[model samples]
Target: MSAPTLYELDPADSGIYRAQMVTLTDKNPYAASVYVYDEDEYRTMRLLVTDDGKAGVALKGDEIVSVFAHKDCAHPKSVQSMLSQATALGGRRLDCFDTVLPDLYADAGFVPVARLRWNDDYAPDGWDYETFRTYNGGRPDVVFMAYDPDRVGGDYTPGVGEYVEDYDDGIARAQRYRPS
Candidate 1:
């Protein structure tokens, strides 16, 4: 089969999910709903809540699906903040990719899973999305991280280092896990 639709631009800008850019409808911290594409391309409506005085993302309608902590109930950015959120979310795993910092993710009880490999300038101007995607590398832009609860609040060295430079190796390793 052909590649799954990486994204659908234009009149029906479907399949493009950007959680980092999510902003709730209002300042209501009690419940915030957002639709974002998980690392695996699965479309999901992530819910952010603060009923328990901690900011967390959940899957099932305001329920803590995963990733929660003592957040601002507004927008949390720190890895430690995320860790606290995850723990508060009732032990849900933090399985996601971070283009910013893999080392910091490791410190937050996440294991560096796979290194993403996406080309620069993938999204060009002038509505040239087709051209960009045609040559777009399927690799993610960040390393996939999986929470290791036992390793939380502790300094644990990742089994493998970050930044997979070899193109072939990157593809192979990524394929093996197909991390989301």
Candidate 2:
């Protein structure tokens, strides 16, 4: 089998990259891990941080290897289209969001889901545990992946304001994969 392609959002992390890493650790002091990958055998890793102050990078031994670039990350329009297709297949994509205007989300075909923390083991923070563990399971840490959905025909970038003007929309399906 062929080797996997090394993917990244930001290849040159440099000073800014380290800062983002520190933020993750600081945010979750009790449980933290850094992801590091082998760049020699595979390609280099690049990572991109989203506007939401979160980047979808896995935890490795010491640091997260850069593998994905935000500049190329799927646009909001693509993600929304993908979600609409999934709905026809009886599949659901759940997303948790803040600061989104309720009406705008509704226009974009999104419904809110609870912010749940599912297990006691992950809920070391008593209050956080109690607050989120309304259901049976728990996963304190989660990652949201980049949007690179498959389109029906060849790639098509809509005209500026085309989507909003043509379709009543606001949010993107990418939010469905957002980390809780």
User: How many pairs of residues collide in model 1?
Assistant: 5
| Per-residue accuracy of model 2 over 54-130 as CA lDDT, tens digit each | 33332222222332223233343333332333333333333221212222223324333223222335433322433
Instruction: Return the top candidate by TM-score.
Output: 1
| lDDT of the candidates, in the order given | 0.39, 0.30
In Å, residue 146's CA in model 1 sits off its true spot by: 1.5
lDDT of 2 at 72: 37
Question: By summed lDDT, which 10 consecutive residues of candidate 1 come out lowest?
Answer: 1-10
Per-residue C-alpha lDDT of model 1 across residues 1-180, encoded as one tens digit per residue: 111111112222212222332333224332221233444432343444333323434443212233433335444444365444544554333333232244555666656555545545542123233322322222234444555566655443433535676545543443344224
Q: Which regions in candidate 1 have their CA more than 4 angstroms from the true location? A: 1-21, 24-46, 52-54, 59-99, 121-141, 154-180
Q: In model 1, how large is the Cα lDDT of residue 55?
A: 40
